[model samples]
Target: MATCQPAPTCAPVATCQPAPTSQAVCPQPCPIPAQFGCGPLPKITNLVCATDFDKAYIPAMYQHNMDIIAVASVGAEMAPSDDITDLAIKIRNERIQQNQKLALFARQAGYGALPVDYNEVAMYRNQLMGVAGMDFSARWATLMVGLLQQSQQSAQLAATRATLPQLRDQGNINARACANEIDALQRWLARNGLPVSATAVPGVCPPGAIAAPYGTGPSAPICQPTCQPTCQPAAQPTCPPGSQPAYPPAPVY
Candidate 1:
């Protein structure tokens, strides 16, 4: 009965303050996403090709090359001792080199060039197969003029249409050379009594080539007007008072 006595509260019941409840650390609310999406997947292809190419340019260039060969074969047999023959040979070699250069240019432009193994001379070599009893040189001369003209046109077209600067310049050179060669061939044909074409190519430079700075076109006349009086009427002089005016004085009649 003595243990059951209430234990005396030490210095008033210590106020048991509830442990301070720490505020719950609240995470910031995530913002709703503002983006959207699509419906179906797309189909794609893998095929590829060159971009920005002229379909006609390379073929026409090749044809021009063949034309050069065709005409070259005609003059190949000409004796080099002959000046005309020598000039023709020189032209042939030069043109071949130029054609190859242009072909290289074409290849660089993502376009196909004349194949290395291609037989440009094959057709020209057999040119005589069908012309029975016809003079091969003469007959070829007939075809040569036309082929040369076509080649020149091709060159001119390239000069105007080519995208490369070097190609355009080379094309202009070839065009002019081709024109001169055509004229020379015409004269040669006339001298040898071979057929000559009547067709004319405009815008071709004269035979007198550039002899001065920026003198690539037709020659300029002396711009300095004549110092002598040009507008004054001619002075009609009396033949020494008509002394023996006629030859032998009209036979002394």
Candidate 2:
């Protein structure tokens, strides 16, 4: 009994397991990770950001971004630095060159003009810039494809409108032929004892006459008044030889 108690009391039982430590269940709010953010560096410099169209199109950079910048900036003294001014001029020149190219392409494609506006192009450019490794070539190719489809639809509509007159003429010819055939059939029916009164003709059917059967039956047949013969005197019987001669009356006007 004494040996068992001594073995049990040895070292107050030190366990091999480490003590429990509390850890945060979820991470605290932090800025977006570097991989998820735009540009190689997590933040963009004002000069580099100014190259972006969205930033350049803001009210602050409106004078730099717009073609009519000089006129608009007059008396409003918020002139950009020389570097920004040069960038704006370059952007404007590049846009003019692209527009000339687009116009040439439109002419070749038989399109009167491109349907998109400069604002749409700028928005598309901004989207491309937001995406890493995206460039203008791919975006413009997609836009041109869409424009071609729209032009084809417009051409089809024009062709349809052009043929509308021919279609109307064909309709009129068919309607006239139908009316002629209806009149001939009505004449034939009238001559074959299916006597149709003048009022019973097409569009002028008599009050109660509405496509009734051709033969006489429960439906009453319309009657026409018959012509009467003119009155004439019958030949007088010969008088007996001995009888007094019948007197002939003298005519007087």
Candidate 3:
């Protein structure tokens, strides 16, 4: 009692934190997509250990998505030429099917892919369009032809330049798909009275040819109701040039 002053009339209010105001939080998008949209670095190293194959393959995958996304986006803009609606849809559908097949090669190799980023797609769309005032059909066809040519070129390079047998097979499949899609795009352009390049791959049907009854939607050949053989064989492994026989013999007892 000697040192203690009179008890404070009231204990000071205990300092207390109001329960943190629970603010609503928005979820964030996943920072990484599908493991960098391919595989982690070490896995890619294991799969494509050879030199420069990755260079060919990575660009091929990029262009694959570019063709799918940009071309599909352009389809919606074809309202100025409504007559080609079914054909446009058909082309989009075909590319999607082909892309699924193309993508499997990577997935089976333990790499996978993500869809092309929307930002890249928007850039592609701008690249497809030119000066604002130009007439729609002709200008659009010219730009589209340019794009398809670039797509096919990249695919063909991957086909020829990839050293690994698996990559070579994938390149062939990818190039074939690009060829089909370009042919489809050309036909779509031609049927709508736009000029297709004389040197472009010829369409299955000449310009202005009418699509068959089932061209669009599930009935289309590419999207047949029955499951088709979308998966192709991977390349078989081989022995090194100077290593043991290409095929190993049965072990002797």
How does each model score on lDDT?
Answer: 0.47, 0.29, 0.46
What ranking of all candidate models by lDDT puts the best one first?
1, 3, 2
Clash pairs detected, candidate 3: none
Question: TM-score: which is higher, 2 or 3?
Answer: 3
Tens digit per residue, CA lDDT, model 3, 1-253 = 4685554343233333334343444333222211111210111211222245654366345554555456555755653665334545654675565567556655665556744555545654664465332255455555455444444544555666665566666667766765776676578667767666622211122122222333221112111111123344444444444443333343443
TM-score of each: 0.48, 0.19, 0.43
lDDT of 3: 0.46
Best model number under lDDT: 1
| lDDT string, candidate 2, 52-119, tens digits | 32221122112112222221122022212332234334434533443454355446545454443345
Model 1 local distance difference test score: 0.47
| The best candidate in terms of TM-score | 1
As for candidate 1, its clashing pairs are none
Which stretches in model 2 have alpha-carbon errors above 4 Å?
A: 1-79, 118-253
| Candidate 1 wrongly placed segments (more than 4 Å) | 1-55, 78-84, 116-120, 129-134, 198-253
